[model samples]
Target: MHGHGNVPGMDAASEVGVDVRWSETLRTYHAVSNELEHELQAGHGLGLSDFELLKALCRCCAPDKGTVLMKDLEAEMYLSQSAFSRTVTRLEKAGFVERAACGFDRRSNFLAITDAGSERYLSAAETHRAVLDKHFG
Candidate 1:
């Protein structure tokens, strides 16, 4: 039965195919994520989440100021608030980013990429692209 006999509207063969595809997808994701994590950590001292947050901030930051609202960035991130906050805290500790209170909204905070962060991001980005290209390109 392969555990698919109970699945309604799906034939055994289709169920097996789906399972194989799902397994492959999981394997690929883990492989790529592991590689990225390794390279990023060795090359930039950053994890995947750290690199991603920096990249996103660099992309969405105000052109002149390199700043964005925490709420807005949080909305874009797929992580839970606590996870996002932890990442932010790590970056802030590393001097990669800064946190500021929003003047207009007391409840809102702004994140700004520091000069050091930009440099790290630029360097890490090259490593990131190379790893992905090596795997997929």
Candidate 2:
């Protein structure tokens, strides 16, 4: 009786494909995330989140001359503003980022990545690329 007792309720079979795809996607994302985190930690003593922020900064058009605004990062990364703010604060404390008032917008603060931060990011990125190539390619 136990073997057949747990049939999923109405339309369950039809929806199973959607559930499977979502689960698979999550699994793949987790695997990639774990690899990235491990590589960053070993290569730069930085967390995956820190590496992401640095990458965003390095990708900025005016990295050396100005800060990347919080709103821009939030939009680009799809992070909540408060989450971005907390991560920025962590980077700032680690000497990987600096905050300054925007020249054009007093209400906006720009986050700039430091030289050390850039170097660390490059190293971790190299490691991450290697891992992906080895596993996925």
Candidate 3:
């Protein structure tokens, strides 16, 4: 449809749709994030980003071995210092995440996912998996 030479059902836009791939990827990620967040909100009563942060922290084996440093969370979550701080604050408010001074590095702080946080993560993860199956499968 873009030009005269374009064949039926083979318009230039149809043939070359890669321009929107980046946007599509971002949109998909956002949709998935929102879906998981909605499930958590309904079932576990936790915010989206806070649930995600707790899940990430729990993945660091904090539950078994204890705590993970704040810097480690920032690096793993790829969040800016201010944004990450805000997330941690929200988590702390929700009783899912907590921060403490790193014993080894006094200047650095540590993050821990609490029991409630772990349970919430597991429940949200199951819901997330079901949503993925419903949408992607």
Candidate 4:
């Protein structure tokens, strides 16, 4: 009888509070993502996903082996398979990333960051970090 609609363990006031919190969190996330997307696109002609892929590739690069396997790259991505593939294709077309057939596994492809990609990532990283620092720091 104390709860909303006479439901047990559920109250109108508590439900409203939870909904408000969830909405606020989502709104904040979207706002931050939008700001980053705008800044990156304006400064480097790269979208947030593009920048993330390039940065991941750079981190995965080794001195002797500069490429990361497609499977490995997929693990680091937040996008769906189709979306990730599309972004990769776009970056490849832009000459920022190159894909090579894996010598060991015919079914696997390796993705490597080109010199241009590295340069672009490094430039955009500064701006990305600055924005994060401003908002979260």
lDDT (10s digit) by residue, model 2, range 54-118:
77777863834746787787677746778888888988888878888888989998777778777
lDDT of 4 by residue, 5-90 (tens): 76646477788798899999999889889999999999999999999998888887786777989778878989898888999999
Please list the residue runs of candidate 4 whose C-alpha ends up more than 4 Å from where it truly belongs after superposition: 1-17
Global lDDT of each candidate: 0.93, 0.77, 0.77, 0.88
Which residue runs does candidate 3 get wrong by more than 4 Å? 1-15
Off by over 4 Å in 1: 3-10
Better of 1 and 2 by lDDT: 1
> Candidate 4, which ten residues in sequence have the lowest lDDT sum?
1-10
Q: Candidate 1's residue-wise lDDT over 76-128, tens digit each? A: 87789999999999999999999999999999899999999999999999999
Better of 2 and 3 by TM-score: 2
Worst 10 residues of 1 by lDDT: 1-10
Best by lDDT: 1
Clashes of each: 0, 0, 0, 0
Candidate with more favorable, higher lDDT: 3 or 4: 4
